[model samples]
Structures are given as structure tokens and as C-alpha cells.
Target: MGTGVVVRALSGRYELLDPLGQGGMGVVYRAHDRELERTVAVKVLPAQMLRDADFLARFRRKARAAAGLSHPNIATVFDIGEDAQDGEPIPYLVMELVEGETLGDLLRRTPLTPAQAGQIATAVLEALEHSHGRGIVHRDIKPADIMVRFADFADFADSQARVKVMDFGIAKLMSETATRLTSTGMRIGTPAYMSPEQADGRPADARTDLYSTGCVPYEMLTGRPPFTADSPAAMRFQHIYSRPPG
Candidate 1:
């Protein structure tokens, strides 16, 4: 909390190597598991926000829920641990180091044929189905939250592509407190993909995920998000009332 950084080995086992990506809560890193002798992704949550006993309890519960998932299309959560940094406990989750490009990055660089889009969509649905069955609703679903790997981009096929849906129970933790999270510089739900209920600050259910997932494929095929507006506020309005472009 004092330093505004998580720069040391977690629990003296997971060594932070390179930062992979970052979001509102914390940064994810490509790390080495000295104990297990393997490569893994470590997501370190901000230290200051976790000092409260109630908040830390909630984090452990949600992290456990996210780690319980098992599916081919969902990245695996291997472990959760904490490290002391200047007398503060920094929590971190060890996850599978998925080797792939984010779907959002892919779309920016390459065009997806209908076949490729369909394959990716099916994989996402399957992942969602498994999570929804477990009563975990991914409140935030967007292109960036999905990772896709292919045997080779030049000769893409259904069998060659692998899809993994990420940050499942993570968003659900932020769902009930969108205003507070936003105040802390955390993005709640992505505008273009959020359902009407989410845009209106309502609790999300399985249908909310379906609504957001529908937008992913729609964007994949159309070369743009189905609905676009000048600002995030306007985008939320469109999500609530307007139909996306066909």
C-alpha cells in the first residue's frame, strides 16, 4: 500500500517475471513457480484495498469460486497465496499461463471469417455453460476477456483453434458495488457488451452473460462492436435501449 507496487516474489515461491496485462484491480504477470518448477500467471491484487478484514474475506471467497472451475476453454487457477510487503499482506492468485492473443487484439490485427468466428463463439458458449451451471455469472464478458490460440493463423480451422474464457468470478465480485469500484478506478462492465440490466445497475444473471457473448460474435463478424457511441455513457444508453447495427 505504501509503495503502490507489487515487485517481489509472492510467498517466496511465485517469482514475478514480466507483466502480462493489467486491469482495474491489479496487474497479471508471467511468473515462475519455483516450488513447482513451472510457468504460471500471477494476478496480484492491490494491497491497500485488502487491508479490511471483511474485504479480504470476500476476496478469498471469490478467488476460491473462480479457482473451482474446470474446463478446456477456461484458464486454470492453480493456487492463491500472500506475501508480506512492508508489513502489508499482498494477495496473489496463480493461474495457467495461457499462450495466446487476446481476442480483442486479434480482431484489431486480423479479419475473422465466419467459420473462425463461429468456432470461437461456440467455445465461449461452452465455457459459459460450464460456469453458469456452477452458478457463476461472468458479469463482464468482452473480446479482451477471451483468449484464443490457433495452430497457425494462416490455416485456421475449428480443430486448430483453442479458446479460453478468463476472469470468471472476478467480475462478479465487483457487480454488487459498481459505484464503489468505479470510484476506485475499476471498470465494472464494458459498455458495448453489457446487457440492459448491467447498464442499469441491476444484478446480472445467466442471461446477462448470453447478452454480452452475443455482442462478441456480432463484433467478430461485423468488424466493429454492434453498437458504438462517442463516450462510455452513451454506449451504455445504447446497450439499454437501442438495437445494434445489422
Candidate 2:
């Protein structure tokens, strides 16, 4: 339960090293795969979340659905399994460990120019376009979810950067089974990056993601979210009605 707890999974084949971070839904860990002899990032759902059968079922379904998405700009999912201890049906996803700073951290040190921001945005957009073509909508697209790695900056007369998107935990697939996975009044996304429709508890579509992405470049350039307010409700109204400053 505490930080740096070693979690063994798959009958003691995988050993988690340390807690990378924790969010509302789950905890991410840096772990080692004994079978593969490599480091991996593991996302483990909390045991308490399993108490809500709907949330548990939906979590597993979403994990499986995300595993099916394969793109160079998207994190690669390696494995999915339940906890080895209690068998409470917690879904843990093994992902390739990326070795670079997150966009959030990068932005804190230096604001991105329009050219740099566009390159990163283009990579995210390509991943979204790929997922959307398969009827998947990523509900979370904040700066923290974007990862950047070293790549060639220019060819001859052009400049580019390699970017990767992580954490597809809240992705929604357009399928009959997906409807049962989501609950009412449970908005699943970061308020700062959520679209107007998403903040209003409406189902998110490709357009919603587009709106969210539109905010990212602005934040990268200005070093602030598009809107700021005292509460999530107020932010929602701003997202729906106000024009962000340039």
C-alpha cells in the first residue's frame, strides 16, 4: 500500500520495483519482468475499485481494448493480468518503459515555441487519428500523458520531433459492450483538458478530442491552461462559452 512496495504478479514472474505515480483510478509502477529480462511500466487498478462491479468490468474491457491498438506513437502494451495475491480481478497492464521526460515536465522548464508545439501536437494527432479510425476515443489527453524522446531534429530543410502518447486507460470503443462499461454522472478525464461536451457529462467523440488537443498547443505556448476557475463546473462553462486568450 505504501510507496516502493514490491508487487509480484503472474505467479511471481513479474516484480514491481517502485511506484511511479498514482491517479484517481490506479497506481503506476516501474517493474521488472523476470521472464523477459527488461524493465516495464505497470498500471494496476486498486483493489477497492473492484468493489464496484461496473467499474471493474469496464476497466478490464478498456485494458483489453487498448491492448489491441498498435501505433508507433502510442505506448506498446505488453501484458494484462489479474493480481496474483487475492485474485480480486485487478487489471495490470505491462507497457514499454519510455526513457524521457513528459511534456508536462518539459513545459515547466521552457515553454514550447509554435513550431515545437506543432510537432508534438502532430504526433498526438496522428495517434488519435489512428485510434479514431478504429472507433476509439481517448478521454484523457493532457500534457502529462504525452512523452517525448530523442530523434533527428532536421532532415535537410525540415525539422521534426518524435513523440509518444501514453495512458489509454479511459479510452472508449464504440461497441455494444462499451455502453455497459461506463456509468452515469461519472466524468472520466482531466478538467483542464476536457472538452465542453465531456465536462458536461456528454459522450466524447473525435471532435471532443480535437477540442482538447486544440488547448494543448495554446498551453504549450502560453504556459497555462486555456481556462482557469474555482471549480470544475465553472471551468466547464468556460470551455463551452469563453474564448481563450491568444
Tens digits of per-residue lDDT, candidate 2, 175-245, equal: 22233434532234457887889777787788988898888888988889999889878888999889887
Candidate number achieving the greatest lDDT relative to the actual structure: 1
Q: What's each prediction's TM-score? A: 0.91, 0.84
- Misplaced by over 4 Å in model 2 are 7-10, 84-89, 151-160, 169-189
Where is model 1 more than 4 Å wrong at Cα?
1-7, 51-53, 175-178, 184-189
lDDT tens per residue, model 1, 22-134: 76666788988998899999888765456345666676788799899999999988888777766778877889999999999999999998999999999999999999999
- Per-candidate Cα lDDT values, in order, are 0.83, 0.74
User: Which pairs clash inside model 1?
Assistant: none
Q: Tell me the lDDT of model 1 at 147.
A: 96
In candidate 2, where is summed lDDT lowest over 10 consecutive residues? Answer: 172-181
Measured over all alpha carbons after superposition, the RMSD of each candidate to the real structure, in angstroms, is 2.5, 4.5
